[model samples]
Target: MALAGCGTINTVMREDGVAARELKSQKTYCQSIPRVYSGVSYNFCRLNGEPNPDGAFDGHLNFVPFVFVDSLISGILDTALLPYTIYRQSADGSIIIR
Candidate 1:
């Protein structure tokens, strides 16, 4: 005796060339923005628990960590400047600039 299966299997095939062509065209037409990792710097300043007179500036910047040798070199060259300024954050998670 042979046993019978409980469910039936169905298969569908697509033969429309116009729908396939349209789908391909639409897929190619959709574009996306390319992701990039550009180095940028954000500067903020605060003084004596108060906002600084100048506003924060944001621009392209190269970030480098300070080490003993670099610090010595910077001191010799007198090119080191105060790096960052502190600012207050608002309730809405935005930086408050004075």
Candidate 2:
């Protein structure tokens, strides 16, 4: 569960490939994502744009439930990290995915 959140994945273990490309495809005007609630924001970015056919997989379908659970966990983690994140947000101005 610690590693299941998209925010964790994006911020800690992201790699350049289908997911990165798909995120890029979202075309969100957001050049950066705030550290506060970044997990939720990552989920939003993932869900915001048109679905990426190539990024979808049967195995991933099975993981949907975990992803939802992880989002909740991520939210809690985000809140816990608020003070530090707020400072990071001001210093860094958010994580740049674009």
Candidate 3:
């Protein structure tokens, strides 16, 4: 498995150097934020005593499985997004539908 950056989900930025904002009222905008799973099995294995095995080498493979599973989950998050709903606050500090 090719290790890339440290696995942490971050806000994607726009061309204008501003963080992308997902407007809750807009279905299109809501559909753009991807869902991510927080799993750290790979990190756990690396913390333990386990050698990083090569692709062709046969040894005690500890983190590979977790890495592969995390990769698949990450891929799914990269593509799918769910809509979000929001409510506005009234002058009296009560939440009301805008």
Candidate 4:
């Protein structure tokens, strides 16, 4: 529970640098995905439709599911890149759009 709280804090309270930019951009990507067939992406728009602590972290949380689905369509094995993805997210935040 405590660890989960840290995710948001980590996202909002992190240093503004390259990593921060990447995280923000990921969220931007999620928002940009068309609503036609991307649940995670659509949820991204909903989850991040407003500015809030959770919204900032939603990028990280949604990344896996996004990649999970994106991978299927694009034929990219994103799960295999979990370490980078997870680290990017944890350092940035995680997905919770369910």
Candidate 5:
């Protein structure tokens, strides 16, 4: 469970430089992302709309099931972090991906 969504864990939970590094490689069109349910949102952002310019499928189809499962786990984690996230959301606003 801990190993799942390693990228998500790095990008969402950690406030250190690790999150920056993790998000650096991702090609997301989102300008500002919500802190609540962020992991699921991140996953959906990657999976949203048509295939990216790089390829037809982007090779992510195979991972759809796994991604759904990860979303569930991430939702739980997000709920657990709600208090802190809510405060962060009010003070800092949404997380900027652009």
Candidate 6:
């Protein structure tokens, strides 16, 4: 049961590969912008969130915490960077953060 819900963010996003580029783009974009979504980006990258099937199982290790911890970290970061990021912009709160 726990393992089922661990796929929270992943399940919400389309897995047909089309969004890989966007996912990668968002991840890299956030990586350069701030450390707020770094954790979420790391998790997003873990999905090998790309169109290639080559590295599908690359990081096959268990990373279930990405669902919750990343969100928590991003929330804290977003709150801290409210001034710099501005009220209109949120560091990139991944679906898990919602």
In TM-score terms, which candidate is top? 5
In every candidate, how many clashes are there?
2, 0, 0, 5, 0, 0
Q: Kindly give the stretch of ten consecutive residues in candidate 2 with the minimal lDDT sum.
A: 56-65
- Residue-level lDDT of model 5, residues 1-98, one tens digit each, is 44435434744667625433334344445555577667666667655534446544333431456667777877787777788777877887766765
List the candidates' TM-scores in order.
Answer: 0.15, 0.62, 0.25, 0.24, 0.66, 0.30
Alpha carbon lDDT of each predicted model: 0.19, 0.59, 0.28, 0.36, 0.58, 0.37
| lDDT by residue (tens digit), candidate 3, 6-94 | 12132211221111221212111112222222113222322233344453333222345655665565445433421111111111221
TM-score, prediction 1:
0.15
Q: Candidate 1 deviates by what RMSD? A: 29.0
Using lDDT as the yardstick, the better of models 5 and 6 is 5
Q: Kindly list the per-residue Cα lDDT of model 2 for residues 1-98, writing each as its tens digit.
A: 34643565554344434334545666544455667787767666655555546654333322345557667876887787788778867876667767
Per-residue C-alpha lDDT of model 6 across residues 1-98, encoded as one tens digit per residue: 33322222232223323223334443332222223334344445544423334523223322445435655654555455545444323544332320
Query: Cα miss at 92, model 6 (Å)?
Result: 13
Per-candidate alpha-carbon RMSD to the true structure = 29.0, 4.7, 15.8, 13.8, 4.2, 11.7
Models sorted by lDDT, best on top: 2, 5, 6, 4, 3, 1
Candidate 1 regions with alpha-carbon error over 4 angstroms: 1-66, 79-98
State in Å the error of residue 93, model 3: 41
Put the candidates in TM-score order, highest first.
5, 2, 6, 3, 4, 1
Which 10-residue span in candidate 6 carries the lowest summed lDDT?
4-13
Better of 4 and 5 by TM-score: 5
In angstroms, give how far residue 73 of model 1 lies from its true place.
Answer: 0.3
True-structure lDDT of candidate 1 = 0.19
